[model samples]
Target: MKRKTIIVLVAAVAVALTLVAFYANSGIQSPKQEEKFRIAKVVRRDLGASVQATGIVKAMVGAEVKVGARTPGKVVNLPINVGDRVEQGQVIATIEQDDLIARVRLQEAILAEVKAEHSRLAKDFERDKQLHETKSISVQRYDLTEALHEIARARVLKAQAELDVAKAQLSYATVVAPIKGTVASVNTVQGETVTTGLTAPTFIKIIDLDRLEVLAYVDENDVGNVKVGQEASFTVAAHPSTDFKGRITSIYPSATIQDNVVYYLTSVSVDNREGKLMPDMTANVSIFLDRRKGVLTVPNQTVQREGSKKYVYVLHNETSEKRYVSTGWKDSSYTEILDGLKDGETVTIGDPGRK
Candidate 1:
């Protein structure tokens, strides 16, 4: 045995130097394992800065009214239908009032036959003015009895103006409801015979669902930062998880193109007193402008712009640095830092040329 093969060739060269020193210490790394970066902190709170229109919900200028039939007739007592609700004077429909109560009783019998011929021509003009002052009346029979007492006082003022135009055409056969709404549409049915001509044919269309309003359109490059009272919010499509709050009362100075894009209608208001909002529906607005309470924020993907200048990195004790900030108001995940950043400073969240 040549000394047992030199002790097994020195244990096979000590197991190939312990497998090349454990693969060169696992291919070197350490420094907290090459830091893998991804941090945040520099915060403080509150931030707003919005403006994203696209609305509809309308109905707020006299809140949709309509109601028609100013005299024609026939629908006789149509009570009310389409969603009813009414109130402001109620009635809602009832035309053919027996030929408007026979023209208000034929103008109250021609105003009681012209007030009984004006009380018999005022008693024959006071007995010919006392027989024409005792001269035995003969000044052409006292000027024809003072022109027959001024033609019976002009036939009692034309029969009291034809009995006040037959009591205003019998109060236009009652149709009422000038507001306080919800009816929406009726157009006639009970006996259907509506006919008015110069416009009063609507018959019903109320609507005041708590006076809604949203309209929003915007986008004339953000309608110059939309302002009127500011602060707003919306979201409808039939209450899509409800958000509805409002303010920006108006802005439409005209400009609404479409397909070529132009917009600018604004408005906003809406409270809808919990009626769940309606009319046209479709909102999705925002508005909010500028608000930055507490300040010192960060996270908007850790800033980092470069052309118009804007930066951030600062991680310290572990390394990162860069910095350069001076933001203001961003929202949608923070930004508003204003100066080089400090609050709790830590920043550094991704692609700084990704390791």
Candidate 2:
């Protein structure tokens, strides 16, 4: 019984010793594991600050045009349709020009008759003047002949003016595109008569797809940071993987309210040379504010603030050392370190006070 009691005592002492050794090893390994995973090295990289906003693709000023008929006439021929590419001065529609041509011909005939009458009266006036000089005609007769010649001249002038007007009306019968663009809509069809009222009746609507812009509704809080000539990038739902580039061209001063949130309209110039972008498409835009190149940066979570001062816990010989730093621009993932940090140094990524 004495031997058994001594053995039990020895086993209890060994188990307690083993447990203390295991706990001591675990405590020593904890810091090493934390340092391995929760630490980052300071490095030099390019950092940029940007503002995000939703936008819509739109046509620039004068990029969209509505072609209308200037004269009232029946649509005789409609040569263009929607999605058709039209050049400037190309005939898009033709009106019934038969009546117009007839009017022009009638004016021409009236002008010819007046010219002939004027020539005959000039001869009579010359003969009368010769008679008057020779005393073979009275002064009253000479004045009468002269008056007839002047009347004929005035009649000829009036007739010529009528002919010019008729010609202009004839030209208006043919509707031509004033700009080079794609036809968006055709409002009138063949056999439909268009009447010109206070405003010309719209016959077609055309849009210049190449001259597209983005109307980004930037939040009022971020409007101050945006300026003209700033570079921007955006993505459309149609082309999710493709990033379109542009520049800030303008900012509207008036604030637009939507659901109680005030926003300012910002115009961004788009390069749609590839022809992938379309008008009215929703866009996700990012306006780049400031950019820094080859600057020392640390992970954003590694920096901690105390009132007006900022500091980081840098790893020095396997121990965390508190170091305050002056920061420059901050991006989504990193912060630019302007002072109190060195290249190739490791810093804690989270609060060092937490185990």
The Cα local distance difference test for each model comes to 0.80, 0.89
| Per-residue lDDT of candidate 1, residues 50-164 (tens digit) | 7667888878889898867777868768877898788898888878778778878988898798789878888998989999999897889888888988988898898889888
Instruction: Write the residue-wise lDDT of candidate 2 on 1-355 in tens digits.
Output: 9999999999999998987788688675455665576889999998886777899999999999987777889999999989999998999999999989999999999999999999999999999999999999999999999999999999999999999999988998998988888999999999999988667667798888999999999876568889999999999999999999999999999998886778899999999988899899999998888887999999888888765468999888767889999876666578888899999998997756566
Worst 10 residues of 2 by lDDT: 28-37
What is the TM-score of candidate 2?
A: 0.65
Worst 10 residues of 1 by lDDT: 28-37
lDDT against true structure, model 1: 0.80
Superposed model 2: Cα runs more than 4 Å off: 1-47, 122-147, 292-355
In angstroms, give how far residue 36 of model 1 lies from its true place.
11
Measured against the true structure, the TM-scores of the candidates, in listed sequence, are 0.40, 0.65
Question: Distance from true position, residue 116, model 1, in Å?
Answer: 6.6
